[model samples]
Target: MLLTVSGPPGSGKSTTAAALAEAFDLEHVSGGDIFRELAAERDMTPVEFNELAEEDDQIDRDLDRRLRDVAVERDDVLLESRLAGWLAGDHADLRIWLDAPLDVRCERITDREEKPLDQVIEETRRRESSEAKRYREYYNIHIDNLSIYDLVYNTARWSPEGMLGMLTTAIDSYDPDTDEGKIPVEGVDYDF
Candidate 1:
């Protein structure tokens, strides 16, 4: 059971992924955590490392390659990242995209990073814009397009626990033998 959780900054993806991993007893991996560790190793902030990556595309490629490798080499893993859904692609049993309003996301980030709301908002905008440009140039991917995802949820409307419950229910109800996995179609508005 491989799950990929992809979302923009502060959409509660990491929190939901962590909970799902625990509930399902799967190994949890976060691309952002790995990137942050690498950034710290080089004594640079995430923004600085992202800037460096812009100059050297290998950084992004390497991270994405590692993600792909993990999907191919492992099962019972929950992978979380901005591009996790695309990287995992058909290999994932469940590919979820979480979204929230920009203001809500900014507020979450402000609380999580202990930064001012305005500062967090500006930083998130800059970072997301940079990532979108690099992802387009590097992978020919349009990050804003959610067509590839199996399930899309608006995280702003649910608590982390609520989201987890909904996801677990969906996972539990999946029937692999019948090829009827209760997977939601792209662009469908889910009442949950």
Candidate 2:
């Protein structure tokens, strides 16, 4: 079973994905983690790395290509990223989108990153805007579109454990044979 957890910054996507991976005994792969590692390796912050990515599109392509390949080739994996739903395409058994109001997301980011709320808010907005532009430029995708996903939840509505429980219930309730949840992404060529 392939599952995808996608959301903007600090929407509890990683937290939920980790719990889901444990609950289902699935491999957890996070694109954000990979990106962060790359950033750290180069002695740069994620914001810096993102700015570089905007100038050098290859960075985004390389990371996204690897993710798309994994989604197509692997099963029993929980993929987490901003664009995991689009990247997984039809290979995913279930695609989930988690989001919250801007203020709520900014607070979570501030808590997670241990940064000032003002700084967190600015950086998060810049990062999301950069990603949205890149997504459109490379894939012709509208990043805000949520129609492709099977489940869309607002993480602000629940605690970490509560969100996990709700997600697990949704996953358990899925009937692959009957539910037509795999919405194949079309018109965008994933040219790896």
Which candidate comes out best when scored by lDDT?
2
Worst 10 residues of 1 by lDDT: 183-192
TM-scores for the candidates: 0.91, 0.97
**What lDDT does candidate 1 reach at residue 27?**
99
Candidate 1 Cα RMSD (Å)? 5.6
What is the lDDT of every predicted structure here?
A: 0.85, 0.92
Tens digits of per-residue lDDT, candidate 2, 36-116, equal 999999999998899899999999999999999889998899999998999998888999999999999999888888999
Write model 1 residue lDDT over 16-92, tens digit each, in one string. 99999999999999999999998999999787788888998888888888988898799999999998887876678
Clashes of 1: 0
